[model samples]
Target: MVEIFGIAVSMDPIWLTLEVAGWTTLILLLLGTPLAWWMARLQSSSKIVLEALVALPLVLPPTVLGFYLLIILNPNGYVTEFLRLFGFEGQLTFSKTGLIVGSVFYSLPFAVQPLMHAFEAVPQKLLDAAATMRANAFDRFFTIAMPLSQRGFLVAATLTFAHTIGEFGVVLMLGGNVPGETRMVSIDIFDHVESLEYDQAHLLSAMMLIFSLCVLMLVYALNRRFGVKVG
Candidate 1:
């Protein structure tokens, strides 16, 4: 029930936005890490195809992605049907969970690319030395690569979370603007504009701009400090 610039805006949208972004970032870290590791080491034609698919969302229009997701995630869509076989009883469409799924897909490239760079930046000689010591892949990844790639982790997480905040069309298509559920700040801003609530729109827009700037600044500051420590 908080008012921004005298335009009433619910905190629910803010919380939901964070919830979706949080889930998206968490999932990206868990899944994108191993995928990025494998991508860094891969050297094959299929790697090119996989990379293209991962990067598609970066270049593709949000509406295009949202449209396809809507089809695929509908209650009777193939994906839902597959889930139903495992005791699922709900549709992904129009739900906060749907927003998270869409956000993860939309932000996949941001997470993966940073992590791939980080993983690849690990010195080959160090890995080779570890191999000579009979250190397995798991051990090397945890003990060597992970430590050296902290910057990449930070970059990936920051980029993914920020990108999720800017999502609009995908969430709109998949989750609508349902309050206390799937509504995000971006959608709220849109609702304000559509309702001719310019004051609210301006406030939300300025807040997002400031928040994004702060996130970028923090990332740069942390990266600088980490680099000094590494050097």
Candidate 2:
């Protein structure tokens, strides 16, 4: 048991939550960067459709998303079967992997929306100048676009990490409560509440509230400092 302010509590969920948030943020940064770049540069009428798809998670309920993910990652589901074709023999549902996947999906908008705005805010003139200097698309992106959008990257990563840490419904539905394997802080708090452990629940809930407030404050401070608009 870990003690927080003289209250006994398990640290497993805390560590697991950090691990999931870290992995989700890293994966989102890697994948969202390219997707955001593409979306920012899109000039076709289909851009709206693609943007809507990317932003779907924002409007979609976490439980609904989680329920679908549970189905897809189940033993006999398409995702599990697809992975089996590559010699993988592990289950996704009720596992840490499932939590990370759900977090990534649930927090996709937090990662992509900021990044897209940042990429879009990059000056076309700068990219055009880079092109005149024989810079390839990759070079222009890595050098000019990425550097200009540094604040956006910060916003995206911060929001994604914070959002993932606070996830409950999606994680619960997809990963269930498997103790050290899949029980996150949110679920742990839920368990405490269910078992009539108000003291423990209050402690955990207060911690979450404080942590969430701090994260939001930090994001807002960054937005002000860098003049980046995060939505």
Best by TM-score: 2
The residue pairs found clashing in candidate 1 are: none
Error of 2 at 225 (Å): 1.4
lDDT of 1 by residue, 47-112 (tens): 899899999999999999999999989888889999989998877999987889999999999999
TM-score of each: 0.95, 0.96
* Model 2, span 81-187: residue lDDT tens: 99999998889999998899889999999999999999998879989999999999999999899888888999999999999999998998999999999999999
Candidate 2: regions farther than 4 A off: 228-231
Residue 20 local lDDT, model 1? 89
Q: Give the local distance difference test score of model 1.
A: 0.90
Best model number under lDDT: 2
lDDT (CA) per prediction: 0.90, 0.92
